[model samples]
Target: MEKARAEAGWLMPKTSGYAACAKLRRRGDYKEGTMDFFDECEIKQSIQRIDELLGSGIFDRKHIGNVLYRSAFIDLLICLRDLMFKCRKFSEPIRFTDDVVVTDEIKHVSDLVKYVRDAVCHPDSDAHYLEPGNIRASLNVLYGKGTLIQTGDFNSVSEHDDDVCFFIGRQRIYLQRHIVRAFNEAKDKLLPLVEAASQKAIAESIAGIIR
Candidate 1:
């Protein structure tokens, strides 16, 4: 398994994603609220944190119960969405190696990420309400008929075995099948951009000193 993972580029990084940015931070070359600061601190750190979370088994329902797992899943979705937003702001068209069209109907992973995050964050706005004992309830988000739906009413959703699907707002999403794969592909594409930005910061610092 380790060999296969290494071959597949699934091995963890020797250093945190912030390693490239650490040089700038150490020299005080970039201050807070700057692009350099955001690149080294927010963008790089977020990718590293996502990597950690994906491997932590927290997203696995067997290891984590209903409420906590859903919370973690929603948080992951939010993080991915934020990362995409930052990437778009910092660098246009985050180039993915493969087609990231998550669903046959949805053209981009960003659409799903935004849709899920928005739905979870503002459920009331969409008239999606959690059940009375939401803290202990199992949830799942289902994509169907060109719309995403959440229902605490299990009978209304497709009958899925708990082992295969992750529960969120009475909907089921397959963790490895969707989230993890998309994250890995995204991280791979984003890392080079982060590294290039870090190098650019270093170059600017050198040029400033020369001037």
Candidate 2:
């Protein structure tokens, strides 16, 4: 995660040329007033949905954590793709190749978010453990080493052997807390980017119509 931020800082430098061009194209058409207010409304609705989910106290921390991280990550990716498409930078794009992975920093974060989601959702799965070390390891794979540090301890067993039962009876409280914090932090980091991308895409689309 840290590595990704650093790389994004380095590679992205500013918004993509594609983004800039798209924004310019949209602004150019503002005189015609072709802006799709409906699309903007939809994006705002989606953002509101996420806000509600994050603010809701109904779900436990782990579940909410998974939802927040997954939703936020996906929202950003879709926003970027939408922006690209609206700007004509990406036309009828097909399957993304593995070699092209590093071109987009959001892709790396998406992968980490998936790994973390899987770890949290299926704690007993043979996949990567949800331990902090493992979480950091997964993030490092995509972003680079030292990008994320797993500061807390994730290994705590119950006194009674049977006490480590499913859902309710384990030491998941701590894990849930950690997951919530991570998701909240990730959401905070990603939301602004997503919003900007969405707005840019909408502006560009309107501009295209006006042109």
Candidate 3:
């Protein structure tokens, strides 16, 4: 500690930490107000975050639930695709050496999401207020590295993450999880191909603008 303080040139005064903390608080020194970009109505009204928009009851909860839950599944694929698209934009198209692509499981989930979207969006609908606690969930998609996933221990799980779906609920509820092991394996294989492609694209773009 002393070495670190000396290295940083933070020569402590003879005064103790308690005295320093009290002095800083008396002057009202640290709490910055929220920035303008954030929506503050929820904070002001003391509305729960999900309740503020998704839970506000402007629309039916079942419809909202179906739409948002489906969106989580849809967005995962979209994010990876968009990231790859952006990476390829300023460079050449990305290529997977093994021709690995979205797994059958992911394709099914994608189709299911589309079906759910149609059901909820239609005026004569098929949406249901899916009892979140009642349904037995299964995993077909995962968002991170594959692990054992049973113990729920931090390190072991990190080392061997199994695919598991999570339903986040409050006023609004949605199902979320990562893609399957196949997806994770493909991502590991393909990221190298696009990583450089993205950098190359970015550099060329900046250079073109300057020229």
Candidate 4:
């Protein structure tokens, strides 16, 4: 602590024992906001796994359930992606120019991600208001009709159980592929934005010191 203060040309203040040590460590390592880049990378990798599973064409209904549950991580990725964009614009002057408008696309994506997250996290119930059909609807919106088919009618349990499961698995794979593609595109765009922003901040700080 003394070394840090001295190097920065500030007076070192004494602190209490364990709490002070913990505080100093936290202060030294603190990030300004919730997003961690590494976690975002992990989410991207998970999205890739979803893609791989889709390509393998070997997953069953239970496997799809696991993927859907794991997709809660996508919400975190979306939050981090938005935060990174905001950080990029942090020092820029606010303006009302039409070109500078923020869109609801991210929010829409987040909402869908949230729906998937909820569906996976909680059991389907009358009170929770989750129907398998809702998941199918969300898949349709995210992936398009060609990739996702919504069937309102299924034959009796013993008659078409295998067919229903097979169809559901196929649709789940399609949904997974679409999600992976979307997240990858978002990541590709946002990473450069974050790097540019960080570089600009560093340049400005250096210029300030030189001045």
Most TM-score-accurate candidate: 1
- Of 2 and 3, the candidate ranking higher by lDDT: 2
For model 2, the superposed segments whose C-alpha errors exceed 4 Å read: 1-56, 59-116, 119-124, 127-177
Give the range of the ten consecutive residues with the poorest summed lDDT in model 2.
Answer: 162-171
Q: Write the per-residue lDDT of candidate 4 for residues 19-82, one digit (tens) a residue.
A: 4334534666425643233334444455455456446543444454555533433443344334
lDDT of 2 by residue, 136-209 (tens): 22211111112123335533222232111111111121112222333444444444545665566555555555
lDDT of 3 by residue, 1-211 (tens): 4333222222224555345434544676324431110112212222233224333432332443455554544444343343333333333333332212134422333333333334434424323223344422222222234432332222112212332332211011112222233233334444454445334434544555566
Model 3 collision count: 10
Error of 1 at 210 (Å): 3.3
State the TM-score for model 1. 0.57
Give the lDDT ranking, best first. Answer: 1, 4, 2, 3
- How much is the lDDT of residue 185 in candidate 1? 60
How many clashes in each structure?
A: 10, 2, 10, 0
Off by over 4 Å in 4: 1-110, 123-176
Pairs with backbone N, CA or C atoms under 3 Å apart (clashes), candidate 1: 139-167, 139-168, 139-170, 139-171, 140-168, 140-170, 140-171, 140-172, 141-171, 141-172
lDDT of candidate model 3 versus the reference: 0.33
Give the 10-residue window scoring lowest on summed lDDT in candidate 4. Answer: 92-101
Distance from true location, Cα of 66 in model 1, Å: 6.1
Worst 10-residue stretch by lDDT in candidate 3?
34-43
lDDT of 1 by residue, 7-103 (tens): 2222333554445346556777566544654454566677777777777777554655555666676778777777777656655534332323345
